[model samples]
Target chain A: MSDDKLERTERALDFSGIQAPEELLRMKRATPARIGIGHVGARYKTAAALRFGADHAAANDAAFSEVPEDIPARLGFFSVQTLCRDKAEMITRPDLGRYFDEEQKARILSSCRYAPDVQIYCGDGLCAPSIAANIPDLYPAIRDELVFRGISVGTPFFVRYCRVNTARVIGPLLNAEVVCVLIGERPGLLTSESMSAYIAYRPHPDMQENAYTVVSNISRFGTPPVEAAAYIASLIGEILEKKKSGLSLKQNEE
Target chain B: MKDVLMSAGIDIGTTTTQVIFSRLTIAEKGGFGAAPGYAVTRRDVFYRGRVHFTPLLPDDSIDKEEVARILSEEFESAGLRPDDMDTGAVIITGETLKRANAKEVAESIAALSGRFVVTTAGPHLESVLAGKGSGAAELSTRTGKLVANVDIGGGTSNLCFFDDGAVLDTACLDLGGRGIRIENHKIAQIFPGTKRILEAESIRLSVGDSADLPSVRERIENLADVMARLLAEALLLLPESPTLRKVVTNRLITCDRIPEIVTLSGGVADLLGNLPEDPFRYGDIGAFLGASIARNGAIRERLNRNTKETLRATVIGAGNESLTLSGGTVFYQEIAFPLRDLPVVTLPMDGANPEAYGEAIGRAWERIREDGETTAAFASEGLSAPTYEEICRLADAAAKAARQKDPSGSQTWVFVFATDMGKAFGQAFRRRMPPKTSILAMDSVRCGDEDRIDCGDPIGRGDVIPVVVKTLLFDNGERETI
Candidate 1:
């Protein structure tokens, strides 16, 4: 026998690498190494919402309580929320949260009156932590900007998966020229707290993407949310003046 | 009084369907409220023809009836009956329509809805994205040439060119994450136990699992490389001058979303780890050989200035998409909503969060939906639902074929050859087995149809056939050969 054959014969049959059962190899080739995009991690889109806080946790109760009349939580445009934190349970489980839960809906319906020129809202997008952290600081700036422009702002309402399409729903709801939505951006590895604005002209369910503008990377460490809010308000200004949102208006400007 | 509304937007996408409820709101006096200067618009509900996010099958068919049923259910669930919607916009993707039944399925959905569904197909996803909104106008202003926006999705990549914010050309390629998973069939096998658990949790249906992990991963990587080249080649076909900037994706897909600021939305450019300090400074002479594209002087300057704070490009692009409009018509008024083709870049999973993955997937899918017309070469017709048992059977048959063809163990012996060749052989061997059977590389293998069979032993000079066949087998499993 040739030296190669002798060596080959002496070598033990390496069976350790057999991953699947021997029966599965009959018509099989080598295992394919498909290196493409992977769903390495996933949060179920249809699961029940988890509530982390205690006492205030709405998950613990299925009923609504009346708000004290004396309390100054009275309806104001600034009091609007684009997303109710309780609605966040609808993130992965949209079915559970797609529609407003009863009490929460009542809270919004009673507190928010309709027919402003533009309804500005902030939602607990993909990152609740960021929404909670930034809204307190950013709301005032945005409100002031809209008020300064003489843009009639209405009580804000939030939605789940508050996409640009959400603006379309808001358009008819507010009977406004536009809807400016400040919601949590889908969080990335770079940062979790970033927020984006979706501003649609003649907002409606059919609103196009260009009708919305985004100002993202809203971490306090980056562009302060307050500053970002100011810039967004200005963009809304341009949208109103030009009556256009995307490349078309930009070109006419140039 | 019950209100009636009718409108549909068919997002014939690479992975899933996004049906928008066009018009269904009560212009109620106190509903949106008093002294209301705002418009109250509502769509009672929209229907989604949620299909399996896979590539088209050889048979070129889809479950039309099932899709229609699901859509009808959605409409009913939304408190609207099928007859309520009078006008609809059926958005067709070029890739999903390729295998033949795309029109049939789309028509079926339209027929069921009982509305005026105008079915249209653009070459790339960017058209859909542009239609949604993106600064197609400004880019055209800067560069006199019509601008093309490419969107990379989970199951396809869509490219679109706009002149003064109007679409000129489009295309789509089925080279997305879902497509990769289906073709490679690795994820299904590697974590069978995990998959069962996940399915039990109702995360994803167990229709396409049953392949090996390594083989699937190998096929996925090879396809990724091929997809990048195909994308570059597609861009070369366009007449627009190459923008000097070369954008880099997360896994170093250099040409994913570079070249222009399609919109001023900040997040679109922020997530890709930041643009190169002088992106326009360097050019791959060999790569952009035919296209005489000069880099945007202003954009290059902007990148240099804000290199420190340009992540979340997709989010900002999504924002920009929201801020723009195409075709001069108000969004709600137009029957066919224009799709925006935002430049999208994707990064590999370097231990990123699920939200990031979802975002990447969402962005890529957006591109596929927007620019499906232009990237026709890369489109898949539709993801036909297949059972796990069928996939397993296919993988088993492929493995058996490999074993029979190279029975001497001589073919298997090649596993001990030089490192690269040996690795390739081993990879091929694995792909021949299990869930790896699902992937189909465009030009990977030569089968019995060509009368090309491997010789009993290795030839001294190395025949190209074996290597190619080996690669083909590795990329796809045994049963996947044409």
Candidate 2:
């Protein structure tokens, strides 16, 4: 119910007797935050209150639900889980989410292709619904662009209860020159379908947090998935040419 | 500062010719790790030549060689050649533009002027630029209020009402200081508008009339009073008198809201509040006309006394303010620059459906097929924050229309949008389009059917497309293509 609601929600100016409704509609369309919503005397109007409740309800569902296994199965993405055992533990034990157990690590090393120029994969981060919504469009665009640009790419896969730093572990195991993780961001009041792309050049366990460069706020309400995919593909090309990402790349540009 | 280029402005008016050279600085304006947008950051006027009387032939047409010679001398004085200017404008304004040979003369001057002055002004453009250079546009922007400027020059009064720095409406009147020219205390010349006014008012004024006669002085003052009252009526947005309606050029003053302030520009503007002792000091009735405008009752209350500019408003605007930089993140392959005078076609977006794109693009391609023109620019006021599905639909609609129009796929296509979806749309077209089509899709530039656009070379690391949205229609009954 929440996933269907997230796809179909439409907003318009909630004002009555307005002289220029188009102007307010333009303003409302320009931003993701709540705007042009009607209010009662000292309170939100009943319809607006109910809509906000629906959105909050949707956000909570995104925070707790699991991405159906068929999503990764349809894309032929091999799946693995981090050290965290369940969603409850994943909520409180973020450090555990960044690493894999021995069996999961062995499975990744045995199943994935070896030492490609770039390795990309998906993760069910705090907002799992975003993975369901954006990946079908986003993943293929990145793959096609990289293939067209003649960059070698490794076999794609998925991770459950994953954090961003999981890309650091995967990069060293495959000996990839660049690693990218397309992960779902935490749900906000405005949207639960937002996603992010985090890229690292030759990432390792010793790398600092600043070693990763990030592109965030990807969704229909933000930079749409296909556009973000194109931008990320070009960014990866830049990283490969410079042989760096994040802080060192910024310094070299300066 | 990746781009610091010299720009020259040359304004040929009915009474005077002015020259100005300015240096424009282009810099990056977008946020870090984002599409790098660029804009002109600063403009410094390096030289301003002394105003000279516009040399005219005996037949009342501008002398092309004389204008070019003056510009050459001024360029030498400024220690620059005519070809040194990178970009600027040559604006032929006022009654001077009505001459039969005006377009030929302007083209000649522009040919000798600079590398690419890619801008031209009709009367409407004149009013917009004068408002900007006179500080009325800035005042309205800063205060977020309504402001108006009246540029009363030798042969015409150009009016622009600005709301928050955008032109709300524009109007021009056929009255100025030089309508009745005085030479050596005798009436030298009278334009047709003034002749009509004199006949209607039953005033006996003619060429070679004595300027020293008291009755003639009284009649001239009465004419000045009538001109002032007509201007006052237009400013107040009152129902126009027949005289006022007869003088309105192009479009009438469209006033939906009252202006909080009014400013002045052009040559005769400085004469107000400092009326000359000799009303014919400038060999014209300019002083009396200025005095009558200053004392007009209907618009006096909204007048701004400290206008930033008077004489050089139009020239300064043409030189330092006419250029616009395109938004970053455009998609183009190998292309040429300085594409000038292409008539525009617009594709307006319907709510949530991109079906309107096909009809609009079909109309444009039909024009192309008829004219045998190889290139045309298609513009859109695109959807803000559009979804990926919406953009793909738009792109598919556009590409299908292009394929239907030219199955050969050998023509160059240009797409300009008012929203930041150029790259996405461009990529979508790339996926669906044939390999032979040359495409240039850009965002954050606007044009209508009445406008022509010029694209200069990409600057700021090829992240910017310098654009000049110009008009080719002269107020006189013919077209001037540059």
Q: Total clashing residue pairs per candidate? A: 164, 0
Tens digit of per-residue lDDT, candidate 1, span B1-482:
22233445445554444444544332322221011111224433323323333334446455566566556665666677666654454544434544467767766665664433334333322343432333444455444444544454443444555554545555444333233223233232212222332333333423353334445334333333333444454444322222211211111122443334332211122222223332212211111111111133332322222221121222222212211101100001011112112122222221113234324333444454474422111111111111222222332443454344334323211111111111112222343433322211111221221111111111111111111111112112221121
Instruction: Report the error of model 1 at residue A177, Å.
Output: 41
Candidate 2 displacement at residue A175 in angstroms: 4.4
Provide the lDDT at B253 for model 2.
77
Worst 10 residues of 2 chain A by lDDT: A1-10
- Alpha carbon deviation, residue B43, candidate 2 (Å): 4.1
Please report, as a residue range, the 10-residue window in candidate 2 chain B with the lowest summed lDDT.
B28-37
Query: Residue by residue across B51-130, what tens digits does model 2's lDDT show?
Result: 99999999888888898889889999999987787788888888887877777877787677435564447778888888
lDDT of 2 by residue, A1-254 (tens): 12223333344247696666755554554455566676778887777787789888988888888888888898789899999888888889999999998999899989988999999999989899998788877777777667767899899999999999998799999899999999999998778988889999999999998888887877766665766776678778889999999888767754
TM-score of each: 0.27, 0.84
Interface RMSD of each: 25.5, 4.2
lDDT (Cα atoms) of all candidates against the true structure: 0.38, 0.79
